[model samples]
Target: MNRIPLRAQALGARLAYALPRPLRRAIAGRPIRIDGQELALDAQLLITLQRLSGAGMVNETPEASRRKLEASERLVSGPPIEPVTVRGLVLGGVPARLYEPAGVGDDAPLLVFYHGGGWVVGSLDSHDNPCRFIAVNAHVKVLSVDYRLAPEHPFPAAVDDAVSAFRHAVAQAADLGVNPDLIAVGGDSAGGNLAAVVSHQQVLAGGPVPAFQLLFYPGTDGTTRRRSRDLFADGFFLTSDQMDWFMDHYMPEQDRRSDPRFSVLLAEDLSGMPPAYVATAGFDPLRDEGEAFADRLAASGVPVVKSRQADLIHGYINFLGVGTRFREALSEATGALRTGLALSGRKGADLNT
Candidate 1:
């Protein structure tokens, strides 16, 4: 809503990215090393810019946070990619967007994607760029769900919408030009949490399970505080204060933190869930929990790949529009999704287990 401030921030980002690494590092201040990992120069520079511009996720009200996220999206999201056509649609009465990359045939794999904002700030516009990137790069169709946010639709509202949208995608896959058997569920941060929960619920329901999962720095467990939560609690873009703010709005009742829908990591069984590629950012507070979830998936005989972008910070997926590292990291993710879906297709509907 406030273009002037966001314009200044975008200019700052462009200048920072243009500078040589040495100069960028100089401006970003001394190397920040914590938890045995050195901060990537790109991440450090963005953090510095954020601090200087006073732009962050935390705000006095959820409405303000939502507006800020929309504006800030332009600052970090790179120029839009072409050849990906997006169409508005409704899934099980929930608003959604379908991204179809050029050249992908009917029966292409589809990914049900949820946007991150700790379940409070992100929206269809805020995450449109990344969804396009994934569709174009992975050669897969993407259904980006605009799930209801919290403090307005708290607790299980988002969880319920996510499951419903995913089910609708499966039921209408043929009409939507996708292969139902090759569908995957994915998202970043809170969206990732929903994707993980969807996989669990589908499996437990005993049919029409997602064939794969692409989780990017997902918050898997809200019930336990891990070391990373304290270590990178500040200065890493996604601050501890912001996390608390999100949890307060989304799952206000502290007693419900252990619900499997909120904290999939605490679920009784990880068995029979879809194969997955779990990505974690080194400096993220949710790092440990995400990796722990991946470990459990592996232990339960689910095929899983845990990737730690050792120098990046949280929310890198949205940064793909600005920096090289962000694009590279996300490219790796899309490539994995491409490969995973291709493999899942080969295995046929048996993957629906």
Candidate 2:
């Protein structure tokens, strides 16, 4: 197999090792203190921070982080894409981007995406490439949502916006030029959490349920501590410390931590949900919970497919041309969408052509 160059790999490892001992310890050992409260860090967050701190220091501000993302996008080659506008506003407001690929029809299936940033970061621009690739590869229109973030708008706000955006899509299906009945919801990390919650909310509200759910290393359980926390807590891009920071800024109130919308793993039931495509990174601390959620969904009779990228790390989906792994990940995800939309009975002329 062709591997990332040894020199690059070595450099990456060294950076991981160079993080301050205390910062590394905080990420790897002990619970994270957030707003004077001890919030136990999950494996995924721990690993994410370790990697971020190791490879490059964490961006202290949202703007700096966005710049890094913008710079990375300069590397990938995406297909012809166009944006669509979504109407009907809700709590977090209505902001959407529709990516139309080459040779796709007006009645194409749609993939609605939520960008990840621990509920506090990430936006439409931050995840543009991934959405474009999905639209092009799956031959479907991709609608990406820009939901409100936190410490400004906490729990239930993001969830509310996601559901609203989804409902707007369903209600204005013809206007958006797609088969409204054949929509899928997908996101990474916190965005994944939003997708799952929105799916549940839509089903409960008797709205159109998405045909498929694509979650990449989702934060399924915010309350339950898992073994992966201790095992992969350090040296990953997302750290337990950063997770605590995010949660504190995003949730704040401890009482709301167990709400199923915030922690889907704690939801009372998982039956009758749409088929799912869950992707997990081997080095991701969120790995276990994401897989566990898929297992639960499968056991509940949801047609679920789980892929664990053994050599890749968290946030690989947004890395674009940094490594071939991101492209491979996008292809697999879009393939799942193709099969998913087909099963849902939506047919675009180019779906399989």
Candidate 3:
């Protein structure tokens, strides 16, 4: 539990993974190979594991859980981009924050972001770093919604908030200094699920469609168990217990799982949705479902860019200092965003990545 032991363990993990192929095999036995590359746990993840060793699947009250997270969590991100003006405001009758990169003004692209905390613990602060990175890297304004949490405001509440917030962002584009048509929607984990559902809801209503959808390790189907659940039930960061708690609080009724709003693939039609950029971690329990959703989107004639970080686990975005793959993945996803928003060929100032 001491810092010395933690650092030592992290060093050991790093050295162990760096050993020559035969030596590593001789010492730690064979490593799992994914996409023909060794899938050994990285040192940054070793430190994270040490920090999370004592944590359980949050059974305390939501407030207590949130406090626990805020007190202990440490997310070391990439070098901060200078002059990123981050400000908080109320949009669509809900809490939200805006991340504005330099040189962007009215008619610039924007993204309405949602944070991932299993519909429970995340807040504007928890996702601030990623929003900053997205805005600066993709050269777009990011509006992050602090939507209502669950048990107090359960299923359909977050969905409603996302739709309202996205609509508000587009409608008030001039005031917010962004192009109404280039407004995109995105999020991680549960937030990603909400973003996908939000897109579907808008299409079903036949109005106010977003320009793009950026989903990272989203939960697409909750009604039925998939092979991924069995294979990745335990370990790999996001455990089964945590997921069970999130689902129970968000949707207590099993029947509701069948709804297209929850089980997105069950939707009769996925047509008319915006372009999508999907990212998934191979070690994650939700990996299969996320990829499945991407396939569905492409099949529905939606332009899709899929990136699979096979060696990394879930929530790598928050593990900024711990991995280089996170940066690589973020850059790729943002590149897709730039293309979708037509930012690559813009005549004026371009975002330096």
Per-residue error at 348 for model 3, in Å? 18
Q: Across residues 73-127, which tens digit of lDDT does each residue of candidate 2 receive?
A: 3323232244433242232258787777778788888888899988887778777
- Candidate 3 Cα outliers beyond 4 Å, as residue runs: 1-37, 40-44, 51-59, 75-81, 343-353
Model 3, CA-based lDDT: 0.76
Predicted structure 3: clash tally: 0
Please give the CA lDDT of all the candidate structures.
0.91, 0.72, 0.76
- Cα displacement (angstroms), candidate 2, residue 146, comes to 0.6
Give the C-alpha lDDT of model 1. 0.91
**Candidate 1 lDDT, 126-197, residue by residue in tens:** 888999999999999999999999999998999999999999999999889998888999999999999999
TM-score of each: 0.97, 0.77, 0.85
Index of the highest-TM-score prediction? 1
Greater lDDT among 2 and 3 belongs to 3
Leading candidate by lDDT: 1
